[model samples]
Target: MSGSDSDRESAKNEAIRIIATDTASVLKFYGALEPSPGEEPLPPAEIVTPEWALFRWVQVQLLMSLDVFFRYRGRVPEASALTHCWYEKIEHDFLDAEYLVLGVLEGAFATFERKLQAYWQMLRPDGVLMS
Candidate 1:
């Protein structure tokens, strides 16, 4: 692998780490992560990995489907709604990265954060491009 490719992998793995950790923390807060019916809790490292992140990603999707059904009763969205924008961007970029790791975080947020940053800096405050 090339230098840039290795960097992309590192970024994806880091994203996996973050998503897994956050999902577990949220579940634990609600006692949903606890083992049931005499089952043993998973090991620390086992719960936070690429595989677990993917699992939780799917799990979240299922929960969202449930929300779609349940939200009608409350007439409001769930406060626990999770967005997949981060997971999606990282996963796609990991398959074929067009930029460095830093670029993933910068560009994939709503798909235009860096574009705004690139041009916003040129604004003269009079709505004119610097050039």
Candidate 2:
């Protein structure tokens, strides 16, 4: 393959990796709750520090994004970036599933920045989380 082709393939692989990771990270809510006793619910999934909240957020986003695909019969605009022609140099009607993958991936990553922000404050001031 050409250089550009190689780069495109690399990017596609990376996107697939991230999409699988985020979707698979969706955790089940079977654990018991144990709040810090006084303060309002916090992250780590509104409980304490279980990494569950972030996963739940991603899961919800994935579900909401998929709702469009399953419920709307995939009626997206021709100008949409995530469509049959997205990942190809030449557009055709062969297996346009990459659009759904891209959508779900976008939804799954929506919580990344929020997750960072949720923990950002911990890196400063009161040092509540600082050891």
Candidate 3:
């Protein structure tokens, strides 16, 4: 191949190498969260941490959909269609029929950081102790 063609091929190979290295580093970071026997297990889901982050980011889109629907609440057709789409995505993706609704609520139990802190503090008279 000509020198120019060889240079382009070399650059493409370097880009692939960089991407593979980055992916390996990310996988290593997530591997740290893996639990051992006798340890409290992580949540069992098909989604990984990165995937979950991406999935939860959809909440922003969900919020926008809800906002538009509320803004045009008097217009039944448009509002209904938006609401339907919102429910469809949430119910299908986040809270599917296979998973109990209570499981979702249980996940939300950790949403209140301060409340969790208070609850843990109650367990220790000194208010702070290493587990």
Candidate 4:
């Protein structure tokens, strides 16, 4: 690959790493908001499961796209437009994600956390997820 291509790939990986770490920390913080059950009892290192990880992975993708949009907001109007389009896509997916993850957590009083839900929900009450 060319140097430009390599640079792009590097940037993409870095973005993925940053977003993944951020989202995982967010999940951990949410998990800390409440207790749990099972053979282990309480605190979990990973919050829920791989499902949460995957959701966060996608969520970070959306975030990265938005970041790119804002990064090029001035020099590249087209980038912003494209990023807006991706934002809408992620917003659509966020609904299914909420239903899937939060719905799963709903049954477990030990797992259910209002603060986490509120944190994410407040970002996009209209289901558009602006930021």
Candidate 3 local lDDT, residue 79: 55
Decide which is better by TM-score, 2 or 4.
4
lDDT (CA) for every model shown? 0.38, 0.36, 0.37, 0.46
Q: Summarize candidate 4's per-residue lDDT along 16-130 as a digit string, tens digits.
A: 4444345565465445554355545444646454345444444543444544554554244555476767677557545545553443333221114453344345332333222
In model 4, which residue pairs have backbone atoms overlapping below 3 Å? Answer: none
TM-score for model 1? 0.24
lDDT of 4: 0.46
Q: Lowest summed lDDT over 10 consecutive residues: which window, candidate 4?
A: 103-112
Prediction 3 global C-alpha lDDT: 0.37
Provide the lowest-lDDT 10-residue window in model 3.
96-105
- Tens digits of lDDT, candidate 3, 64-104: 33333443442435454667676575455343212212222
Clashing pairs in 2: 45-53
Candidate 2 lDDT score at position 85? 46
Q: Order the candidates by TM-score, highest first.
A: 4, 1, 2, 3
Tell me how candidate 2 scores on lDDT: 0.36
Which is better, 2 or 4, measured by lDDT?
4
